[model samples]
Target: MKKLIQFYLFIIFSIPCFSQSFSFEWTKQLSSTYFAEYIWEIATDNDGNIYGATDGGGIQTFLDTTFDVATSASSTVLFKINDAGERKWLRHITNSENGSIAVDSNKKVYSGGWFIGSSSLPPYTLTAGAGFGNSSYYTTLDSLGNFTSATKVFSGNSFLNSIAPVICNEAGDVAYIDNREFPSGFTYIQYHTLTKKNSGGTSWTKAFTTTDVVPLYIDPANNLYIKGAYTSAITVGGTTLTNSGGQDIYVAKLDGAGIYKWVKKIGGNHDEWLQSAATDADGNLYISGYFNSDSIDLDGIKLYAELTENNSFVAKINAAGNYEWAINLDSNAYHFAMNLLVDEDGNKVLITGRYTEEMTLGTDILTVTPDQNIYVARLDLSGNILSGMQITFPLSATIYDRKLISPESMLICGTFSGSVAFGDSTYTSAGGDDGFITKINFCELPATYYADIDNDGYGTPDTFTTACNMPIGYTNNSSDCDDSNNAINPLALESCNTIDDNCDGNIDEGLIIATITPASATSFCKGESGILNANTGVGFSYQWKKNGVNISGATSSSYTATKTGNYSVLITIPGSCNDISDETSVTVYNKPNATITNIDATNDLCFDTSIKLKTGNGVGFTFQWYKGATALAGATSNIYFATTSGNYKVKTTNSFGCFKMSTPYTIIKTCKLGESDSPNLQVLIIVLVALKCQQPIQLLKIVNFGNQSL
Candidate 1:
């Protein structure tokens, strides 16, 4: 018994023991030496260059495959990379102000946000002004790092927060979101503008507005979609939509003409806001945001049972303003949802936020944690958490935003203290709010499979194998039908003619099959037809039927149709069917003749209008209408018009006989008098009447007889 037990263990752990393993090594950092401060954002440009935004130190630019900084003196800069991820550039403005950046199709950058002062000078200084109380401004720049034009598009005492622009039309036009302060309170609205160039240079025209515009996205059709929260009444698509709770996320759709199509609000009684929105290649809209629910469970954590600031949730919304799925991220405490980025596959979403160390359970107990650590989590398209990874830096390090550099790479930017990894080397930031950038490259080593050859999970007594060739006892082992034939594997299924005989659920599935189906025998009015059908099973489906009745879905068979007017059936099936059987039909009826009759046109005999002739069952017959001796060249049987006062006749000929018929009809034309002739004709009639008077006519004077008539 002891020997048998040891032998069983060996068989279980043998497979995993031989599996290959790989290790990951960090690369060098890429940044400048000027005490990199808080890195707000990191992006790779079109030429594969790296660019990062600094909170106070401006922007840092990197070259191709180099960790050394190329340039590092851009103030209030927002870095951008093209869709190709090759080139990189920065939208820099002087005097450093808060703003958002967007790129158009032509590689032009449009930055809109609040600026401080005046809009003069080369770098455009923003000084104190009337609307300079943290008001918003919009500017445009060319691809060559030159300011094309700057415009103070919006101005107000209220803060213009969370601005996003999208290239909605091919004309390089953009639609954006802006929040304005009303007398009552602050209200978020959407605005759009188009650039036009006349003889006097370029100009902009204000298009339209929408309410609660936070997240803005434009589809390929130039349709604008916005999401945000509104308190008071706001008009969207010309209809006023109201929000119930204090703060709610509202989604509004607009047409290309700047007309609102529909507006939908999503949120509970508490504060809910959508942080990011994107459109897939299929034009499906996806949005991610935080929801404060009173009753919900997230990741096995209870939330919202009591009023607590820590209850926060993450959710995804579809294009139709419907929730795809919602996942509660924090149940005990408040977790802020910052930014959402989609990877290349577009099937996974990356959510970045800061979760406090404080926890609240049954009571409002706040743990005096030092700082909040930034957490980045990956989720599937369905809002299911795939992996939750957290990077905890010192309290001074503030991660502003992060983006996926590639499927396996990510770049994070924010404020950092001390020395932080940039590329290959560690870069120490200048204390007091410096910029910091970090790049993480993830290498997905090939999968290694370990089988329980010895029934043990440990590597002991187990053999490991590469995914390509799994060892025996593994799930993939069943793929090797003839283990002796090294070539006989899952990959070799195409070369074999047997059905996944390899147990891969694929039959000679990939192998081509030659099908041979004999042409179906033509059916006679009454006779036996010999039908021979054959197929090599290469790619074919055959079914033989007699008189439209399938012969039990038979692939190869013959049938006879004795009595029939027309008999036919189909053969070739799709997908697996390559050969098709010819459609055989036998006709037994001769052609029948049809004739027309009871034909009429216009009103009755009194009315002078075109008339028609009727015919009866006279097949293959031709007709000709005649007016007196001349035949109406354009006239045909069944209908003839009387152009003159005479009798109309129709002559028709068929295979049986020729027939002729006539109908009496009259034609009358109306005449009208001209203006000049009307006056003369009236005078002539009056003179003629005067001469035809039989009695001596006396000039009758107007007698004013009120009571008696004279």
Candidate 2:
């Protein structure tokens, strides 16, 4: 019988198993294209069309597989794309000197630039008017590549060195930096704006001005942030102005109403200009620029802030305009940082720059030999240099401009010394400093996967086969059954056998059972016992446990534990089968305690009061007084009463005890009809009266008993 029972348990524990898998590879490089003149910017539109802004080739458009240059003499070549990576476009301002490009959500391109010529066509005739003020224009383009409107946003006799435009809001309002000449002969940063209605009109409002020369950025809240170099000391908007050196990078934050919130100066004695600034999701500002630290440490670090003459520097500033970290890359004396691109993860920044090396002649004849190699470096968000790699192409001339096309690619536009080999073509320098364009693609390899099957970083030599069965003691990777145990093999179903058929260590581990008991039941109070029995498997040991601990000396088919607690039992067959039944638990709750006591109403009595109220004398007892169904405030003592006639009761509760109430008491207010009651009696009456009055009176007293005096 025991052997038969063991076999029955083995048949109950058997199941199936499965596995998981994966793989990868790389493709060849795609064909590349070349361009005439140096490229300043390469941006990809939503549809994957590549747009290259070249110095001499106007705007080069590579659309739908064709590489062609758009011949527009007025093209300044500023490119930007939408969030979806589609709708590639370039901003061009006619009759203007130099300009910058910005795009809005409506796909409208906003171009702000200086006008150099008087002619309305190509080679816009340059008019030598005021010192630096003849070229300033603003134009907007629609989605279909048509110029919706053009307006001379700002025109002055003073020279406008730089113009930066930004969309301030979704309402089509734009803000830009206008570097107007100050009366002190120093250029100052001025804010200008254009409304939605006057897209073509030459109407603009001068918002604000600062004693600095640089572009300003407008945030989502319509606040303005400006960064640039300042010379003379001038106070603007209550902020004290101070310069670091010849030209130090200065930042100013303004409110929506063009009011200055704070101004910050960063850098040392050397010339430091903030080239670009970006804000993170947390509003922390990141500014990058070239710092020539010759005498002072802008960021306090000699390597990062000190002027190394030729090395370039990048620094990160937090939202409060405080320097967080900084790093210096390379020792090339003529290295210039052009642009910074953040990776998709936003944790790393890619910086692109041009490195130039100078060559020396005889004793006193030192010539500047320019290597003009393109260098790119990846840096952590904290400004720590990661992988700094440079790719130098031997060109006959210098590389004047370059821009990043993608996180892994860049378009280098510069005047090559001679014909240069690009992707699949060669770009020849147009005679005297001809413009050249080339695309550089950097490929990243896939990461390898590793699995530690033996609990080590390395793997072991384990043979895998297609067989469905294997010899005893050997695991067949494909089968979930244990061949070593006849009772646990897949052939067994459910006959109460006891064995690990699935190769697992335990017997009947995965078996299931059902149990039923009285849904609603009761048990005795404290110090009393009750019986709890389960209708389960036979021959079970019935070792009862409570709250996960074994109940000493309590072993029976049913447990009679006196104390209340969670109870469970384990059943063991104790035979060749050695099958252990699953443990089941039941919770036992202790009954509430009960007690009774009486209250002394004599000394605590009120005027005209009768009947007695009481409380329990139980330990940990607390009392509460109720008058006509309403509990009285501060009445939680062992005794309680009222002077007037009304239903009164005393409630008492203790630890492990249920709340109990005393019999209701009745009190009546009465006074002598005629006689001036005895002095002693009157005194007692007055004291009781005060006690009754002390009872917190409800706002609306239902009855007003007649007042009497002795």
Candidate 2 structure, TM-score to reference:
0.44
RMSD of each: 31.9, 27.8
- Badly placed stretches (over 4 Å) of model 2 are 1-96, 116-133, 156-175, 179-212, 216-224, 255-257, 295-307, 330-334, 342-346, 356-371, 393-402, 414-418, 429-437, 446-710
Q: How close is candidate 1 to the true structure, as a TM-score?
A: 0.44
The deviation in Å at residue 519 for candidate 2 is 66
Candidate 1, run of 10 with poorest lDDT: 4-13
Q: What tens digits encode model 2's per-residue C-alpha lDDT throughout 286-402?
A: 555566665435445444433356456666666665677766665435666655554535566666555664311111111232333655566668776655544555455444334
lDDT for each residue of candidate 1 in 453-495, tens digit (9 for 90 to 100): 4322222214455433223344423334444444445555454
Instruction: Give the TM-score of each candidate.
Output: 0.44, 0.44
